[model samples]
Target: MIGYVTIGTNDIEKSKAFWCDLLEELGASVVMDAGRIAFIGNGSEKAMLAVCTPYDENAPHPGNGAMVAIDPGSKEMVEKLYARALELGATSDGEPGQRIPDMFYGAYFKDPDGNKACFYQFA
Candidate 1:
């Protein structure tokens, strides 16, 4: 029922580089690269994380109360990716840990474009 998620960015090149390096861990690469927009995928139908310039020609900003949640391969993968995100300049929103006993484990971060995302696993 889900398709893709788009994150706006004022600096398309910077956002692209950020994603390219980050997604390299998941074996994803640029599948669509237009001038102002780009997308990456690792052979998934849902691999549609886009970084784009605002169509209205205004500055890009993160939408309030909006976020994208990512489900990685495992808890260890989540931990690794979350740390890697910080190393690549993303800010930590939450540390990786069990969230709600017997329910889930997760970590959150704000991307270079200020788009917030989560990496989660279930126990």
Candidate 2:
């Protein structure tokens, strides 16, 4: 029941670089680039990720505990995405591993803007 998510950004270009490079690997691309750019997943325009400077013109601040949970499609994909995020300068919130054995497998990290995020698979 989710359509899209918008992450606040103070520097649009920096945030654009982050999301573009990252989401493009997951099959999304820049579909909207007006005031706020949004990356829409291939074959689904309804679900998108966007970055925008606050309308009030204040510095963008990441909300604590808010995250965009991603599904990279497999355990291997999860591992790869987690590692790639770190390589691109994202801080680790938690390393790649099982959060609950035989149940929930998860990995966590903070994006460049310090937004908490994760990808997981059912084990």
Model 1 Cα lDDT, one tens digit per residue, 6-73: 89998988998888887788887777889898887664475578889988989988988999887878
Q: Rate the local accuracy (lDDT) of all candidates.
A: 0.87, 0.79
Any runs in candidate 1 off by more than 4 Å, and if so which? none
Q: Model 2: C-alpha RMSD to truth?
A: 1.6
Which ranges of candidate 2 are over 4 A from the true structure?
A: none
- TM-score versus the correct structure, for each prediction: 0.93, 0.89
- Residue pairs whose backbone atoms clash in candidate 1: none
TM-score of 2: 0.89
